[model samples]
Target: MSQSTDFDLTSSQTAEFDLTTVAFKSNPYPILARLRTHDPVYQYTSSPDGQSTWLITRYEDAEIVLRDERFVKDKQSTLPPEERAPSAGPAPSVSDLFDLGMLKFDPPDHTRLRKVVNLFFTPRATEQWRESVQRISDELIDKVESQKRMDLIEDFASVLPIRIISEMLGVPAEDSMQLHLWTKRIADALDDPAAFEQVASDLQAFYTYLLALVEKKRQASTDDLVCKLMHASVEGDQLTERELVAMIFLLILAGHETTTNLIGNGILALLTHPEQKQLLQAQPELIKPAIEEFLRYLAPFTITTHRWAREDVEMRGKLIRHGDAVLVSLAATNRDENKFDHPDTLDITRQENPHIAFGKGVHYCLGAPLARLEGQIAINTLLRRLPAMQLDIEPEALVWRTGSTVLGVNHLPVTF
Candidate 1:
């Protein structure tokens, strides 16, 4: 469906757009274009508390918000008195296990914390996992090859990453399913504040699980990533116990969820645009560039993490008050016509694809290389194994996930 005619800007007030709806999640590009053109620095008042969040839609402005030091990620510390959200109190039984990791910190702290895990994500480090990724891909494809039909997300994409992450964390194969359930529930709970009670329960359960796992690793001193993280220190700087668990939790959540979305969204994009699929299948070598295009074209993350202004600032003719929340729409910015030629079109071979799907600057996704590696291997393997695969349901009948920061379908049924 072409969104040019599907959306009417005048139907509702310009700033009334909300991402937590099925309508918005189904097709956000048109609304994104409208926002980019009319109000690059848009403001929307959240209900109940009347909290305001400045949404940066255009490419240039969104990039600025992401990289600029004035815009800090941890709003709890920077937000002004009235702007600050009410205290939700300490973690009841989980302790500080749910605390934000390096992703939420800025400057020296962010730099310090990122260093511990940085080595594991480098291209060289990621390459070490490529063979393992290929084996996992082949195993997954083998399962579906005979079935002829599968729910791609649950049966394939979702399984690959969780398994890999569990192995990396030293979790036994038998316990993988439980870990997957915990992470999935926690990730789903992100946009639903009403799920706080359930979320708290899940967090405590997950925290307790990790605590036991960490202790097991410590007693044995294995070579897994978790064991390495436990022993890692720099210049007399070591992660506190809470930081250690929180970082591991962050790793597992980010490590799998984003890659799962990448694979799910990438396949859906190609399935919807058969020409692109044909092009990729014919050329075969375009998988790398195709990965970039998919990241830009379908941008799994609609917006980057929330940021708050440290002081009053003016940009794009708008005065952002101090402590005001700012969110950059990665999906919108990647599709900004001002930044790319024919931004809406999916050109698998397009060069100069500088999309911020993984974000930018100090906060650029640490697991990006791994995600890309897994994506390339997974998609290529899928196309190679099931060249005749097609969707089992009508495109419009497909449901997009609601009330979630990560944009993906809950289930993608396909047949070959």
Candidate 2:
């Protein structure tokens, strides 16, 4: 990677930072900015109960690391056999095992898995889902409009994506409320160790619920995604039962989490910054660029991608040891001073806004088109439909999610 930031990994001293605390939780922008400028290749070591990982915050470094295949995703292959198995004694839930969805796979596996999922979202295929997406958004806003200062998260953002994904998977709307809670709990547990046991339990329940749904799909002939996978074959290879379950888990959570934050955070940003909101309201055509800028401006996934160094590779002028976790802080990178001019400033009309919020390389997010369509439809429709859309409370008064693994506000109360 060019424009390397040299650092000696061996002799480095560590800093104390709890990724899941109120300070970092309430606001991470300042910390991200500080790390981006000062400690670009910062190694965050644990104090007592905390776990340590290297945090790469700069634009160039994040781009280089996220795209580099040498920093691999299949750290499972490198794990000790004891660590590989779930406790080595009892076989655990599917979540405990190496869940190799498209995100978990590397290279050829990643390519193949992504291709199968991409078939559902390709430009040609996406047109069919548009009507469904629009219908979902309108119904959601209808609910939102009727509420007494509804939360941007629970009332709108979180539910819309869940409905879209659940319906896509042929999961009945009756099942959506529980499934959405499970997904949120799973995300919460991932970000906060305090929530791990509860999260794992929720995950098991989610898997169990999904299994029943899969069985229904198996017996019936439906055009939902689970059936699509059941019938699909690639390179003469059909997906195994375990793989199918894993795919459902991955797709639902991935689709639900990131886009929810996009809608929630995007709304927060526009509401917080009135001038930008006014500009968009004046010219709704800017929604496309505005969405791109929003993704960059408030990147949902803090560290969207993580990898382990393959074989002691030299990147950013640092010798990263094999099996070491390399994280690209997309949250920090999106507002990177080098990659984006006025990175912290949100400009809906910016000529060039290249953000890695959807990720990069062969592992780019397949659902990006669908997410964009959903986001644009939601934002534009809200502005046009809501008689006088505005935040009912101060931006600071809203409760930003604590230990938010993927950055989002828990509550965004609004009035129309």
Candidate 3:
């Protein structure tokens, strides 16, 4: 998109990096690479919010920040009530759901909340859904077979994850579309401070919907993830009403949004890389490894959720003060030449690939197993089912999602 930088600190300091532009969103790798090479720990005032955040780009530095307890998740832990960024937002509003979720919490509180559902998401437990995942994948493909040409994202990629997660949450199929739309709006607000007010209104509505859903599930006591979590207790400590709602909100939002992008982006990667696509097509056994490559090459999330410093900390010759926000660039770390032989090249047969696409340490992705299962099944099945599948539109015509933490194309026109 723009001229590549060779880690020129002077040029970077003089210029401002804009994350809101189409060019940046479409291809942020080049800039990310420059930061990794020239300035591993770069600090910048965000264009949208004007908030300062340290960008940890190098693989070693990112891993250290992600695992280090000194850098806490909930900014409230380190800052005082008024000083902290809303520990629980405001009373009676679901706006605080994010702060309550385990993503934003440090040890003890984070450990307790994450323990509630960790068993269900483990690789062993998630494998039970393999057959069901395969069935869902086939059903989705069957719908688009007659059409021949379809938006791969809407018609297939997006549908599969929402359906799987919706069924897990015991939500009726009819209501999934509404939840998806609301989640998209919430994700949009995450990257665009300008949309905060609108997203707040949407959150209120979503909170109300979840409140009703929880009551219904409680009354029925069905066999689903919601019911299991409702009854789950850790060391005799059950989830409070507010905690329950927040947990469900986190699951629904993270469950589908991340995987939706994973499937959509993975498919796009394979389609664009004909040699790798052909390699997989010729050797179906390479599907699993290929899926990992897809995750590393086209990271579903460009950056990890925000982490705040608990105290003054010095990293990579930069001093990070208390309550400062930090973002780890997973895309940059994944492509670091220090870690991989040929950082930019896509190789399906990559062995012992230590990519942190799902992150590292205590807060690593909980649903990673399920995401991998869905991705492997979805991509392999799509390629096998539609042997001649090809992009029906030019590459330049593609439009990626904007002002969002996640990375994915909005529409992928393809035909078989």
Question: lDDT for every model?
Answer: 0.82, 0.75, 0.82
| Residue-level lDDT for 90 in candidate 1 | 45
Can you write out model 2's per-residue Cα lDDT over 203-230, one digit (the tens) per residue? 7788788778878888887988889987
Clashing residue pairs in candidate 1 are none
Residue 408 lDDT, candidate 2, scale 0-100: 77
Q: Give me the displacement of residue 130 in model 3, in angstroms.
A: 1.2
- Where model 1 places Cα greater than 4 Å from the true spot, the runs are 1-16, 79-95
* TM-score of model 1 (CA atoms): 0.93
* Each prediction's number of clashing residue pairs: 0, 0, 0
Judging by TM-score against the true structure, name the best candidate: 3
Q: For residues 31-97, what per-residue lDDT tens digits would candidate 3 score against the true structure?
A: 8887787778888766444677788889999888998988888777886766656557456467557
Error of 3 at 279 (Å): 1.1
Give the Å shift of residue 346 in candidate 1. Answer: 0.6
Roughly what TM-score does model 2 have, to 2 decimal places?
Answer: 0.90
